[model samples]
Target: MNERFNKLRQYNTSGLGCWVSLIIFALIVGKIGLGGVVSGFLILIALFFLVPVIGFWGFQWWLKQKITQAQCPVCEYEFTGLKNTEFNCPSCGESLRVEGDRFTRMTPPGTIDVDAVEVSVQRIEEEN
Candidate 1:
């Protein structure tokens, strides 16, 4: 996943979707109890579109903010905002795009690099 998306994941990890869904279900049940089938159905129909659309858009905005705040390690160029596609650094002419579990431009030459150190820590912890 991209570092930008990772940031969004941080924001949304509290399970906002699940909470909203539960609330909607509760509201639907309440409407059914008070106003009968017709009223319940009407509210459900409105919420069906409103809840998911707003939730998705909010998540998108959060993700976009994360993308914009990221700086290219090679060039130190700041992204504008809401990048719908991959971006390259403007200063050093290096790719700022993240790939898989690794940061492309940020990786170093030696085996004692950050990634290697993380792997070493995991390996040692697992052994213990």
Candidate 2:
């Protein structure tokens, strides 16, 4: 569960936070003198950047809490993150079916039919 949350958070930084922080830094340095820059500008920059982090963390926490967890359908083996449409099941090497939150077995053991099994990758949604 922690692993899932961490992975979600790691991939959620979309570079917008850094751009906002940079803008805040530049505005503070240009408008206010050095004495006030650290106090005023840094606070703005930190606050802006912190928003994304907090949002990302909260979203990841929700996915881990609510989403259904499943394993390789064909083989009954547990796995995560299948990037390709066709992948050998980690345990049985048989093609698997991944649809939405559940993985259903499409083929039985000792079967190697490419046309039999279908693997679908679902898009992970971030909770608002």
Candidate 3:
């Protein structure tokens, strides 16, 4: 899951760069004009802005879905609001690191306990 997230992030970043370049190109074209095709030029300008707005919104929505589905490894807490790399456990007050689908606790060097920490897999619901 981490690998998949990384891939998606990379793709989004590349796409944003492409969109920026296209915006620049559109500006240049608009300034120069295309043999007096004013309507077509206006349409191109609208698309130049529209495409990036849609892409950004879609990317944010997808990220929100992934964050909501994340489960804490220590307290089994499902994250509900904003997504971030680090979050303090609401139930146990432990600091946890979120990486894709995996959650890890940040513990002191000598306080590690193998048996006390309970690790459980979250069950997925099946549709009938």
Q: In angstroms, how far off is 25's CA in candidate 1?
A: 23
Q: What TM-score fits each model?
A: 0.33, 0.36, 0.43
* Candidate 2 accuracy as lDDT: 0.70
lDDT of 3 by residue, 23-120 (tens): 98788678876655577788899999999999999999897766745566766877643445677877777788766556778777888656576789
Once superposed on the true structure, which residue ranges of model 2 sit more than 4 Å away at CA?
1-39, 48-52, 55-68, 82-86, 105-128
Query: Candidate 2 residues 1-128, lDDT tens each?
Result: 68888877775559989999999888878887677976876899999999999999999987675554468754567775433244556787765555676665566679674647678999999999
Q: How many backbone clashes does candidate 1 have?
A: 0
Q: What lDDT does candidate 2 reach at residue 75?
A: 55
RMSD of each: 26.4, 25.5, 24.4
Deviation from native of the Cα of residue 12 in model 1, angstroms: 54
Q: Residue 8 of model 2: what lDDT?
A: 71
Candidate 2 residue-wise lDDT at 90: 74
Candidate 2 is scored at a TM of 0.36
Task: Quantify all predictions' global Cα lDDT against the true fold.
Answer: 0.63, 0.70, 0.74
> lDDT of candidate 3?
0.74
- Residue 128's C-alpha lDDT in candidate 3? 100
